[model samples]
Target: MNPSSPDGHYFSPEPSVASDPRVVDVLLDGVDLQLQSDAGVFSHGQLDEATRIFLDGVPSPPAHGNLLDLGCGYGPIALTLATWSPGARVYAIDVNERACDLTRDNARRAKLDNVHVSTPQQTPADVVFDAIYSNPPIRIGKQALHELLATWLQRLAPTGVCYLVVGKHLGADSIAKWLTSQGLRVDRLSSKQSYRVLEVRRTDREQI
Candidate 1:
């Protein structure tokens, strides 16, 4: 397990929190959701603003296909995807074992059988996703964040798209430029509350 800070390390492999789980309620698409969260994960006290904006900006996923919630801290994005796209297989990948544990229980509580929570290494390398969503871990540092994006972005299907939200103060523009330079099409879907909602697609074909 990667060494972690117990207070709140979304990327922690093994969080040391004493298992004080809390229930959080969030409304999405007019439906109420109760999620289990704890101290060791990201934004455990409430749904972070960036994620709420991401959810508001990205529409319901495709009805049937593979979907990924990268850095799925306690499964908000993953669970939402599972609930919104019942036919799709939603994979929630997180390094923090406690976050994964919370997500698993949350999914079960929600009666969602389509969620698969695991560490990145446990995910099948051969599987590709139709769409991916995240409010990425910006504090993870530029090099590490770039590598994280590259590892999974490469697994996107030819026509796949990724939706992300990053705070402007967190260098959103820099990351967008970097992504474009790497041969992906980057577009700003919205900017609100100092956050940028970015939509990325592979430049697999030349534009006319």
Candidate 2:
């Protein structure tokens, strides 16, 4: 879903496209939200189908703990998690500064104080996530995607879980195999609309 824009890729640190902001109306878990979106970010105008499916399928987040929304675009997943778990601290991380700014603005507009919008490097190094949700930028290429996942997955709490939605055509099964090879436990939670929703956890927690 992260195709190159006229100026640069959506993953670019600073997108070169002119600002074109808009309000996106989204309904998650029966909660209505008006989020600020703009050009140069992923799914600028509306919630993409993959994310819609991912949100609809994932289980309820932890009641209170550190949560992460990786590759957060315009704060849809991050804001939704904040709405769902008001007590949780939601870290919304992205590489695009424009996207990060949009997320911060949207969070402020929604009055969700629990969300922390930042670039990956800006996230506190000592924080461990209780849960992570992502509709990753698979188009970033396999090596980059692998590195990105590895970095964050390592930050998962011992008993933490990461829920991801990847398209079947985009090699969801292969990613599961790769995660398994890395000594993580991967389960296909559901398959809908050619997308695979994966539930991942540390294998060491199996005995617990």
Candidate 3:
């Protein structure tokens, strides 16, 4: 098991405090999703710049069956993904209980009962994602961040893909190389404002 975070990593299941609730709404690929937020969580009041860039960079999933919003905070990406793909069942996982509760409530408010919001450990064993999307927490340090990604990358379905947004200064290029070394093909699809949108997949193929 990885060591518990001193930085109060957002992925830590045990949260520090309960933030006051507020609501936020956004349009993603023509779908409008409204979710609640609270203080101290990632992008609590409105969509954070990184996630905004992430959404802007990537197109909506053509088809969604099983999806994951890794480190889903207050359900922005997860809720938007579900709204965009009605056929998808999104597992919104976070370590913060308050964030989890907020996601659950926000999904309920959006009338999207298909989103399963809970802690990382609450996710079932048999679930394999068709798509995994996240604005991964890079401040968590390289080793810890890699561990987080590694745990979930293995959960990708045979043809599944993950969309990630990372700041350029945070070693996004090195991360791509590392993923490539892991046999997961990582493509730097787009870059802007020193941020990168990476698309990763696993296959029986050689490095480029």
Count clashes in each candidate, considering only residues at least 3 apart in sequence or on different chains. Answer: 0, 0, 0
Best candidate per lDDT, number? 2
Pitting candidate 2 against candidate 3, the one with the higher lDDT is: 2
Error of 2 at 163 (Å): 0.5
lDDT minimum window of 10 residues, candidate 2: 1-10
Model 1 misplaced stretches (Cα beyond 4 Å): 1-8, 205-208
lDDT of 1: 0.87
Best-to-worst TM-score order: 2, 1, 3
Off by over 4 Å in 2: 1-7, 205-208
User: Candidate 1 lDDT, tens digit per residue, 156-208?
Assistant: 98898999999999999999999999889999999999999999998884321
**In candidate 2, what are the lDDT values of residues 77-166, reduced to their tens digit?**
999999999999999999999999999999998899999999999999999999999999998899999999999988999999999999
Candidate 3 per-residue C-alpha lDDT over 85-180 given as tens digits, one digit per residue, 9 for 90 to 100: 878899999887878988898888889977998787889978988899999878777898889999988888877789999888988888888888
Model 1: worst 10 consecutive residues (lDDT sum): 1-10
The lDDT of each candidate is 0.87, 0.91, 0.81
Q: What's the distance in Å from true for residue 27, model 1?
A: 0.5
TM-score of each: 0.93, 0.95, 0.89
Give me the displacement of residue 150 in model 2, in angstroms.
0.3
